[model samples]
Target chain A: MAGELDVGYVAQLARMHLTADETELFQKQLGDVLHYAEKLNEVNVEGVEPAAHGLPIFNVFREDKAKDWFTPAQALSNAPRQANNLFIVTKVVE
Target chain B: MTKRELPALSIVEVQDMLRRREVSPVEVLESLEERINTVDDKIGAYLTRDLTAAVTEAKKTDVALPLGGIPIALKDLINVEGQQCTCGSKILGGYRAPYTANAIEKLRAHGAIPFGRMNMDEFAMGSSTENSSAQLTHNPWDLSRVPGGSSGGSAAAVAADIAFGALGTDTGGSIRQPAALSGVVGFKPSYGRVSRFGLVAFASSLDQIGPLTKTVHDSALLMNAIAGHDSRDSTSLDAPVPDYAKNLGRDLKDIRIRLPKEYMIDGVDSAVKTAVTAAVKQLESLGAEIVEVSLPHTEYAVSVYYILATAEASANLARFDGVRYGHRADNITNLFDHYARTREEGFGAEVKRRIILGTYVLSSGYYDAYYLRAQKVRELIRRDFAHAFEKVDALASPTAPTPAFKLGEKTADPLQMYLADIFTIAANLAGICGISLPCGFADSESGKKLPIGLQLLGKALDEARIFQIAHAYEQSTDWHKARPKTIAEGMKRAGKAGEL
Candidate 1:
């Protein structure tokens, strides 16, 4: 069964605001996609486990140590707006 | 070979010429410049190029190294230090990379020059390069047709003879589908076979960076350069990298190839089916045994992929909110409005659609019904491949259901476009390696020749086995030798056309 999607609510959750036209369009398109995905219900997944990854990757860890990486300037190079080596943004606590 | 024809030659051909001092890397860049200036106007394969720096690097390079001084175009998503890393989205309009990708680092270590930036579907979300916010890439075979995406620019550049070779990522069929449509050799190594340290994530578990080149041997050479472990990418395979070119020219005497019944669905174009069918017979003639196999859950692959890939994409792309690098919204209602409006203004429709659907699936109420269900089905899909692998050495199928479709043919219907990846999506789900190489040509209704690709899938980390089979077939067939006729015309326009 295709879940009923509230495009406006979903868009808000995704941190996006779709136009009226975009909402209607995506709603239909995503409806078809979700409907197609309903085919998953045909198979029995009762005893099956979800795949963790496409490959069987073993444990990968590194010792806690700092290595040479990009400097503050390099990291801030593409910042849309910067000040004192920090990224600028709209006020959140106002 | 004369300098006029230098850019059109394969990596091996150019490597030989450079090592013998017949032509310098500077000469190769010059020839490429001429070709690109002439052809790229119609092809639109490159988003950006840095030939001055390329020539500078080439002049100092040692042609004696394995990939010494050869130029390989990069899909825009792969970051190179100090270069613009636009993943074909307005969100990343002016962002430049702070560090190089591990793949690029390895390629540079092998003496390869990564110069040009190729276009792709915006964030590699679409099947046709039409989704690129930068420019639309056209098929070299027919200017009106599309080069498959999201590596369309990479494929078109190679097909147009403007790029010697290119590196492209395949999450779903970004590399192979485009390679098929453009008539080149594209290989998607096993998941984690190549490190993805600097690759912008789409679906982290599904994405693998690979090569799109003129021949099977060229792809092998590229794999030797880029495949290995990296602690930076925890998922990268810690396995030994093999000489991918070492098994070429070997006979397929004992190799067993399986023809999956599910791949030849009713929706497949008759021409593509005929081409793949003939390719199977050709392999048999080469002394390989052919067997029929069934991937029972193959039908569920695309559905699983869309759900899981989009879910991962939603989470992966969450970092694009207007806080750091990339486009920041000027609209200042509040903190939330900044992120919402910035993404709305920055991302394209298809991207937003995926993000919405992705967020919805992983949303509180729909998690088990969509995301988890898809993963469980994904496990079944993986088991189907595992079961088939127990009996056959490799599986064969059509790389794409059909050759290149016309521009805007399926854009209005996103589902139709998603179905285009039907044949190639399963490999990514199963975590197997696959290669698409030219097998035959299908004449379009207007009588233009379109290349068809035959895909061969091998078990995890079995790139060598698949390469051997593909190389043997490539050597046996003349299909790989045919280049798009527009190449010569483009070269002529550049005043660089001449016989070798």
Candidate 2:
């Protein structure tokens, strides 16, 4: 909750290619949320453990056997582009 | 029964009629289609509904099953195999789910017919449905106000009598707030009570699926069909799920309901505060011992929730990068540029704002200061519940600080909108079960009677207890029996605006 928010840096990190107007607007809005969240610093949490989730969950092992799964055609059903059961995307390596 | 009359009935009533062979599933579909046709043009509660497909599926309804042939509307984020799972974002435009989610699979297996494509805030982010690029869903109580979101469509449709029951996801008050605003019964099951395998993820840790319906008993019926352990959702509790409807119709003989003074703060609307106080007094009259309690950390719940929820949301939503499915940017030769450009265009203003805020809090320099501190504070909030529940059967509070506001009331100020959910978000933060049911109505400035809700919070996996209490209160009052006056007005408005 500390430090003035740099919307440009955060948006870049977030992959939100914002326009100038969006950048200016988000800077002010995100600043307000962060400002409101400054109240968290008041609570003393010196020795408390951080809870990753609401409940404590230990990993469970499922039965190690083959099960009904999405077929290749099914997996490719919503693909923006598909060829030979493979999802097509822009070339990663030029 | 007349097709016009069927849509107004509850899930239980329709199920009884269906079981007695008084009306077939086909009739229910026709009835819903008629009602939705009459009112939905003004409400904007649905993105799409396939009557042809629904009628065909209804033809095979089996009344012997619990939800058999009963149509339960679904919030758009939930996936039914091959159905559009847009989550009200243009990013998922033209995207159909590849397979069904675990909860829907359970519901479908129990003979429930998956009905309409209910609207929502894109990715279930906003408290008001205004953020949805799909359409603005107006409150059924007043044509000019909002149906609270991100389950706006789900709540409005049920309140408007277009559907008997609905499935909505609550991550920081999405379900309960909307239900309160729309004057319907909405229950957010304790986290892990329902599986999230098929839900489009938003703030993963806080997200939960729940029911919005006409009555508490109907919520319990829908909960029974969908809630149980699923091996698919790793966080789902493997513990037993009780029949949520079994202990209903009981008096609160020795139940100790607590009143958290922190929730009765000064900022709450006088009408809402008075109504909630009366509801608590009603419970006391029913033999409940009202004990005043304190959740000292209640002041920090919203702060902790925004920090943690947005942090998780930023990561979960990173999957939508114009690659596998949904909107893909054209002429983006660069792969990285493709993700950036596509998201900016496909997502709405609110979604992007949360993502950026989320990314900020979780980013390197601020990680320990914001995210870690919030997690620790979250533990404090949870401990408050753990201690309070040790002595009480449930905690009573107003669901939202105020009744439904006009459409653009809080839209410009995002932080003000976030504070509207202050009362209900803590239950989600603590990972406990909570239900919001109609307690009374408040007169809006327009002289329209807007519904206010009474919220009951129970311990983890204690949905049955709260349902029992809520059902008793609902049975004793005529609040749930009140219907909106907007249908005829909507028809008149729709005839004129072609745009209402």
Which docking class does model 2 fall in?
high
Superposition TM-score, candidate 2 onto the true structure: 0.97
* Candidate 1 error regions (>4 Å): A1-3, B490-500
Q: Which digits, one per residue and each the tens of the lDDT, describe model 1 over residues B1-500?
A: 45677777889988988899888888888899987997799999999999898998898888889999899999999999988989999999999899999999999998999989999999999899998888899999888899999899999998878998999999999999999999999999999999999999998989999999988999999999999998999999889988999999999999999889999989898999999999999999999999878899999999999999999999999999877799988857798899899999999989998999899999998999999989999999999989899989899999999899999999998889999999889899889999999988989888788989999999999999999999999999878777787556534212323311
The chain B TM-scores of all candidates, as shown, are 0.98, 0.97
Per-residue CA lDDT of candidate 2, range B66-181, in tens?
Answer: 99998889999999987999999999999989888898888888898899999999999888899998899999999899999889999999999898999999999999999999
TM-score of each: 0.98, 0.97
The true-versus-predicted C-alpha distance at residue A33 of model 1, in Å, is 0.7
List lDDT for all candidates, in order: 0.90, 0.90
Which parts of model 2 have CA positions greater than 4 angstroms off? Answer: A1-3, B488-500
Candidate 1 at residue B144, lDDT? 87
Whole-model alpha-carbon lDDT for candidate 2: 0.90
Clashes of 1: 0
Candidate 2 clashing pairs, residues 3+ apart or interchain: none
